[model samples]
Target: MAIKPRSIFEEVSETQKPVAAPGGIDAKGRGARGAIRVWLMMLFALVVVMITVGGLTRLTDSGLSITEWAPLSGSVPPLNAAQWEAEFEAYKQIPEYTEQNAGMSMAEFKVIYWWEWGHRQLGRFIGLVWGLGFAYFLVRRQIPTGWTGRLVFIGALGGLQGAIGWWMVHSGLQEGMLDVASYRLATHLGLAFVILGFIAWYTFSLGRREADLMQARRAGDAGLVTLSGVLVGFALVQILLGALVAGIDAGRNFPNWPLMTTGTGASFFPPDPFSLTPIWRNFFEDAGLVQFVHRMSGYLLMAFAVFVWWRARRSPNTQTRFGFNAMLALMVVQMVIGILTVLYSAPVQIAIVHQLTAVVLWIAILRARFLARYPIAQSIRG
Candidate 1:
């Protein structure tokens, strides 16, 4: 006797019984996504902490502490009086200590020493977490083939960031400079943003896959994705300009927003007129111009975000509409934070928030982009 074919609903319900509930993803699948999402958020948070610690290290003039670059050995902090003295002696040989921190005792060295130590330790922890997490996913065969290559690429980028950090430090250790090269400072910050952007993109990708599997596509999807990508690009550029401003300590001079200095008119330009010559000098050495440019970039980014939101409102997709609105709100908050940071001369609390808000906005934009691209996929999964 031949068996009759089951109805589509009956077949689906049978499958659901084994792996997931009706209208829900499986427990294992949900758990995997949850773990990955948490790890990505943690990485983002760690970057913010690293940036804050770096700012403090700069403010305290502690970046050059423990001059030696013993990547393996330096992981262990000084444990005794003799070890502390040895570390202090290493620091004393650097120009920063001799020229700027001379006459400082071992006790004083300890203060700065700890800040640098904490920064390095955070870097190591990030490496370990990413490495172990990726291995776990790989062994379980849970990570999709499409994402495996990207994960490896990001892991390598993390390693490169470590090397770049030491390269930045090595500049100050060389003979002539009392502080790290401003250009190196800019590069270090630029790489941090790169890592951040990648993380935001990856997290958005995962979220998009889930959403696609849940919701069906509507209209204006392609335009929305394009707009999202544009917004993220603009935000990244603004972040780079902000790094330039920080590198030259530009915040110290232009404490006012909407104007370069406290004065009025064209005199507000850097005193030298052709002031920032050689192009390169303008980016790292010309404090006034750097800050001015950064302020202008912020305004540009805000305008772009608002425009994206306005266009998204016209789209038929509800999720895209919500994401665009989120992007718009974050943009406004970020602009306010940037102005406050400038007006406050980049105070530690405000400055760190400014940096963090940028990351948040990037993530929002990424979400919008992913939603737009995968609407159909989501509907099928649902």
Candidate 2:
């Protein structure tokens, strides 16, 4: 007699035993998303701190003290007096030492060396954190599908940033060069903003499940979407201009409000603006012209932020409106910090605060844009 074929339904019901509850995604999926999002947020905070530290290093005239990349060996730093003297002697050979800080003592040299070293050390730590966490999640199969490439892209950019940092520092070491090239500084900072923006967007995307994001798309406002995008692009340009200003020490040139002019003969425009050769080079190298552009850009950024805020107020989504409101507030505060930074001649304390405020503004804009793209659903009664 032929063996009776077991009933398919009976076999499935008895042996299959739920096979992951019918959906391709399971509860583990949500846990993984949450874990990854938290990890990204931590990285985001680290980067923000790193940016602030980088600014401080620049402000303190410490960026050029290291004079070497030495990515792996440099992490240990100088442990003995002889080692410290060796490091200081090496630093004395650079343009910044001979030209800008000729009389600096070994004690002072140590001060700057630590700043640059700390900045690099923090970067190394960030890389370690990202690498280890990513590998762990990937091995455990916790990273959600379709996200491996995006995650990998962030690490790649981060590694590129390290190289860019070294490149920025090298520009200062060349003969006759007192500081990093303004354009290279701008490039390094611009890439930082790009990385931060991507992290913010990714963090936002991960906050909600895939299904939730799909469902919320219908409710997203087109006007808000366009306006938010415009604001983000506008903010990035302003950041670049700000970087140009900082790179050239433009903020210390005029130290006036409402324009580049101050005191009795104060005028909004810089006097004798065509001092730089190549004509076009004045925009980046000339302190007077660079600050002039930065001031005007500030005005434009403020006006544009207002326009976006005005449109956002009319959005039906409460969260979206509140987000815009917060962004507008940050824009105002950031403007104040920028002005204060200028008036104080870009003092180390004030300048660092100004940079941190910029980071806050940058995050605020990203969050507002995220809300525009994936607005929170309000109750029908509200």
lDDT string, candidate 2, 55-138, tens digits = 988888788888888989999999999999899989889887887799898888889889999999999999998999899999
On TM-score, the candidate that comes out on top is 2
- Model 1 / residue 277 / CA error / Å: 5.2
RMSD versus native structure for model 2: 4.5
203-318: candidate 1 lDDT, tens digit per residue: 76565444344454443377777878887777777777777776656776777766665445434455442465677676667777777777777877787778878887886656
Query: What does the lDDT read for residue 8 in candidate 1?
Result: 72
**Clashes by residue pair, model 1:** 212-377, 212-378, 213-378, 213-381, 213-382, 214-378, 215-378, 215-379, 216-379
Question: Which 10 consecutive residues of model 2 have the lowest summed lDDT?
Answer: 22-31
Q: Residue 280 of candidate 2: its Cα lDDT? A: 93
lDDT of 2 at 81: 95
Output the lDDT of residue 123, model 2.
Answer: 94
TM-score of 1: 0.81
